[model samples]
Target: MTKREIDEVSGVETTGHEWDGIKELNNPMPRWWLWTFYATIVWAAGYTIAYPAWPMISSATSGVLGFSSRGDLKAEMTAAETAKQDYAQTIAAKSADEILADDQLREFATAAGAAAFKVNCIQCHGSGAEGSAGFPNLNDDDWLWGGSADAIYHTIAHGIRFEGDPDTRYSEMPAFGDMLSKDEIRQVSSYVASLTGNSTDEQAAAAGKQVFADNCASCHGDDGTGDREFGAPNLADAIWLYGSSEAEIARQVRTPRHGMMPAWSARLGDTTVKELAVYVHSLGGGE
Candidate 1:
């Protein structure tokens, strides 16, 4: 039957004689939709020929234009490298001290170093370099190693307190657990606290003074002031490595705490390391 007549007719076709008032229409596919489907097939064939659309055993087919995602990425990387070359040249030519002197260059280095710190150093040093219980605060002037440009650079290039590193800085604070009794530890901690003028029990502080004279006088001096050459922290100052809590101090005296700050020179490059040191030094604690 003609298309229009087929649409108007009721019960045009049925599988068998219907028992209820339900029947199926004798439908044909829409001609417009059929034409569009044919068009899609043709378009797909054209697209397959012009683009890398087909898969092979080992790789995909190359398109007529020879376009590649890898090639695009390579071009982008090359452009980025070219842009960075000028900055890199400036960094290489300038000395760390010179960079520190130039406000503009120092600013650039600061920005660059900040980015590097976020990725590499911030985890241990903290975002502000204030440090945690074990870690040393970069914002403070107290450096176990040295804070000079060369010293900072060297430290970054070669890590300290790390295993398997031949040149790694090595020093172990002897654990007093086996040597000193609990009362002695508490006394020593109180003495250490008194040196810094922190609140402490007078009796405990007095007892700790004798322990300090016997055990800690050589490195820490008679007054509990530190010897920088030995990397001993000054007990006279308010700065505490682990913390100032009485409990924290007592624990340290009993067990000792050794924290390691990673070196960044090799990983961040000399210029970046210098910039980071300068930035850290300027953070209200540079001596």
Candidate 2:
């Protein structure tokens, strides 16, 4: 038979339609490819039966094994808690001071305190305890409350400015607005500025001495040296809480400034609070 005739008579036919003088073959899919397509369908059917593959209006189909992603997380947490129990039990038996001495307990406390500080103290104390405008530096020697280990522990246990905790440290810088005249406040501010070697109007500072004697002497001492028990900051030292500017001082005298540090005892738990105290104490300037 001739080649053209043979092609025409072959059972594998050509598409009846042609485009641009070219005809397409009407070919069956490869046997292997067909088998693969069928296998995919069968696998999908099995998967749908075994797992949560279908979605409903308000819920998804529960798999036969009743597996859940949340269950995996809970299992992981349970294991971690089990591991932590030993350390927790050991810490519970020791005092904060003893924990500081023990290498393992100290390491654990440091880690725990750092985590809690990031969560709680960082907002006011800064990530590195650098402190902000009103907040005191945990890294510095100047402590409103004493810097001893016990002192820090006490402060953390009972937060300053916390309402309903009568034992919580409390101090109020009386506003000069009702008590001292604006001129007197300005003078006192100038005198406060002078304590830090910050430039002040000489006349204002002169007038401020009288104002200091009358209003600020009780808590700040006659020379602005400050009272530790009262938490009154020393104006003589360069450490300015609200800022050393004449305006800031004047504003403080006129409308006073009160800063409250949140107590961390309950939030950080006892061991962590102790660790934070130790960490702050270790900071170079800590008293």
Worst 10 residues of 2 by lDDT: 1-10
State how far residue 269 of model 2 sits from its true place (Å): 2.1
Question: How much does each candidate deviate from the true structure in C-alpha RMSD?
Answer: 6.6, 6.4
Candidate 1 lDDT tens digits, 178-275: 99988888888888887767746999989888998998888878987777667677778878878886678888877887866565655666667776
Total clashes in model 2, counting residue pairs 3 or more apart in sequence or in different chains: 2
Residue 266, model 2: lDDT of: 66
TM-scores for candidates 1 onward, in order: 0.65, 0.66
> Can you tell me which runs of candidate 1 are displaced by over 4 Å?
1-87, 93-95
Model 2: lDDT to the true structure: 0.78
Best by TM-score: 2
Task: Give the range where candidate 1 is weakest over 10 consecutive residues by summed lDDT.
Answer: 2-11
Q: Which candidate is the best by lDDT?
A: 2
